[model samples]
Target: MVDVKKTSTTSQNVLRAHYKTLRPPNALRGNEVIILRHAETIAEVFPDWIERCKLDTTQLYPFDLNMPVRIPQRPNMKEAYMHDPPLSEVGRIMTQIFARELVVRNAIPRQIYSSPSLASIQTALDIKNFIGNQCGAICVDESLSSNRHDSKYWLTEKDMTRLRYCIGEFCVELQTEKSSLNDIVQDMKNLVATLVQKKKQHYVVLIVTDSLAAQILYDALSGIQSSYNEPLQQLYRKAERTFPPVSSTVFTPSTRNGILVMEPSRNSLRPLTRIGETTRPDFDSEEYVDAKP
Candidate 1:
């Protein structure tokens, strides 16, 4: 059996120490944001989909994570819109285990929000149910979903390759005249700021979202700027190996005084700062992107 108290205490101490030097300049230092990735999907369903489409996963490199093997040519708006997949058996079990840990620590969130995507919704519901909290509403927001921009469902191999490098760059390259990259970035920042404000009044805010949104939000909160000129492969490789699947990132407000950030680290929700400081890159000058090409 895991010692929930000891583990939570140790994790909290580690985070408090680490963030002392690395906290972002403008972050909401005292508030806490928990970003959780949805659990693994049912492998059988995806494999069946791939077989039906005659897609090849072998073409992808081992390091190329999160690239869809196949995309629907004519994706149904309802089906393709963050198509909700039920969690795998393993995903259910993982959530239960983590939920138990949260219960033991009395860390059940005051409120829970999830991406409109089916998998994310299920993950949030499972956690709320296991924690036995009926008072807190588990609301679904489309903004949290990856389809927030109403972008297409699938991407070409070249696009996927580019995404593997830097998601920010992918956003820049894939931006349509209808949706500017600046707008997307600002929207994300706004969402984050709104959540932080909510956390100020409430105890903790839990956001269950997709990997791409999770990564982008994490980078934003940490104030790690991505360069348009950096080799996409280099950035992709670094993030792929450094982070774990089903991992959690905690964002705490920056503070000068040493007030310990007390949060339980259950399951994959460990301190991400241990990975190292995310460097700030210049994004303002269009010259950065032009210089690389």
Candidate 2:
């Protein structure tokens, strides 16, 4: 299992620093975007989930007269191991703590963007529930989901790695317009641009996503340090992915007047793919398959 990261001092410092910006005494406040990593998942918290997953799925489903109705007999064990697993009991409590931190800091967001992964959405939802954000304020962004090109970035498979059910879906995968590291940066740029344009100044927005994706967002928008020598993606790959559950970084877009325009030429970006799409892969076909070892 990938090590779960604890909340960092730096993020806490940013939260401390950001509290002042939210209530500035001057003109209308600038856009404050808080990029948050999702909380711990069932797979991350429960060792027994994998043990239950190892049972033959077909035989397990047929209910017996002696079998208790709860726990392992439930349909979602395979589904939980197969698809995006929801939060565990511990994970739910962690989210509550995270939500309360936001309230205490006065960092309530006007709008929210979330990755489509079940865990990411659940994390976003818990925060919204705490602060009373309407459904309309939250959106599931395809760009914010796992990077379409990289199998490593895909969700749900992490807990099931080397397990049987995990292998099939990824065995033949189709890559998409979100093709490279540059595309990751571009997608986040577009996200920031859209929110900055749509919402009024001082509107706070929250983004809930995976940690590596959050790292990309942070490195792209927060500016790389002066001392780092490697290329951005190289540097990115080397950085540790672990971060506290629901860890966040607060940023205001680097702006000229009020908005920050970070658009690359339309030609540079992939033809826009709609949300909730699942395209098939023809492994035999000689399409643009990114088959890297």
Question: How good is model 2 by TM-score?
Answer: 0.54
Candidate 1 wrong stretches, greater than 4 Å: 1-31, 43-46, 49-84, 149-182, 227-244, 254-293
Model 1: per-residue Cα lDDT at residue 133: 37
Which 10-residue window of candidate 1 scores lowest in summed lDDT?
165-174
- Please provide TM-scores, in order, for all candidate models, with all chains considered together: 0.53, 0.54
Clashing residue pairs in candidate 1 (N, C-alpha, C atoms within 3 angstroms) = 28-253, 29-253, 29-254, 30-253, 165-232
User: Candidate 2 residues 174-252, lDDT tens each?
Assistant: 3356566666557766665676576446666778887667756655554432233456555434332333455566665
| C-alpha RMSD (angstroms) for model 1 | 14.5
In angstroms, how far off is 184's CA in candidate 1? 3.3
Candidate 2: count the clashes: 0
Q: C-alpha displacement of 172 in model 1, angstroms?
A: 24
